[model samples]
Target: EGTVYRQIPDLIFEADYKDRWIELQEAADPWKCTLPGELQEQMKPFQRLLFLKQIKEEKLITMLINFIQESLGQVFTEPPLFNLNEAFQDSTCTTPLIFVLSAGADPM
Candidate 1:
């Protein structure tokens, strides 16, 4: 007999991290109201931090997706065959298996 398995990942979010992101958004909002030249110097560090964080997240996601694809490619290189009689005849044969994995809205 063939068996199917569904896998869901455990995701954890920190309250402090969420709060810090809100704070950054609040601090950056004022720059939009002020003149570019007046606030450019003051906002440079915040802008830089946000940009670097975005780049890091993008790279991490890309790496994760690549890793998952490579692993799956290796695992499922051959299509599985399901035969009840053959499985019984061959002592080495075990149950056939299938895995279904899903990701969330964010690629992680």
Candidate 2:
């Protein structure tokens, strides 16, 4: 049998930090209206905080879909134009639109 062991993150080993993380998790609502200080600091390097700060639960799905579509149209795809009239020409068809992206190009 092959077994693998991994070192745990230092945060989990510290009693105070572990307790604080648990407390934060318990207190946070479903949408995470407020994030813990440590997590906020970690996200800063990746600019995740900047993006997350403006998020609203109600519009999150629409915003994500729009972001993906916009990124595909602007960055990943060539000839960035989507003809809505052409796409919906057949009202009876229920075929979903799928994108065939090039290698290393992810709209998300």
For candidate 2, what is the total of clashing residue pairs? 0
Per residue, candidate 2 scores C-alpha lDDT tens digits across 36-99 of 3354434432233234334344545544444445445435433568776776774444676666
What C-alpha lDDT values do all the predictions have? 0.38, 0.45
> Which residue pairs clash within candidate 1?
none
Model 1 C-alpha lDDT per residue in residues 1-108, reported as the tens digit of each score:
011101101101444345544543444332223222222334344343344344354444433443444546544444588675765665543554443457655423
For model 1, the run of ten residues with the poorest summed lDDT: 1-10
Kindly give the number of clashing pairs for every candidate.
Answer: 0, 0
Give TM per candidate.
0.18, 0.26
Off by over 4 Å in 1: 1-66, 71-79, 91-108
In Å, residue 61's CA in model 1 sits off its true spot by 13
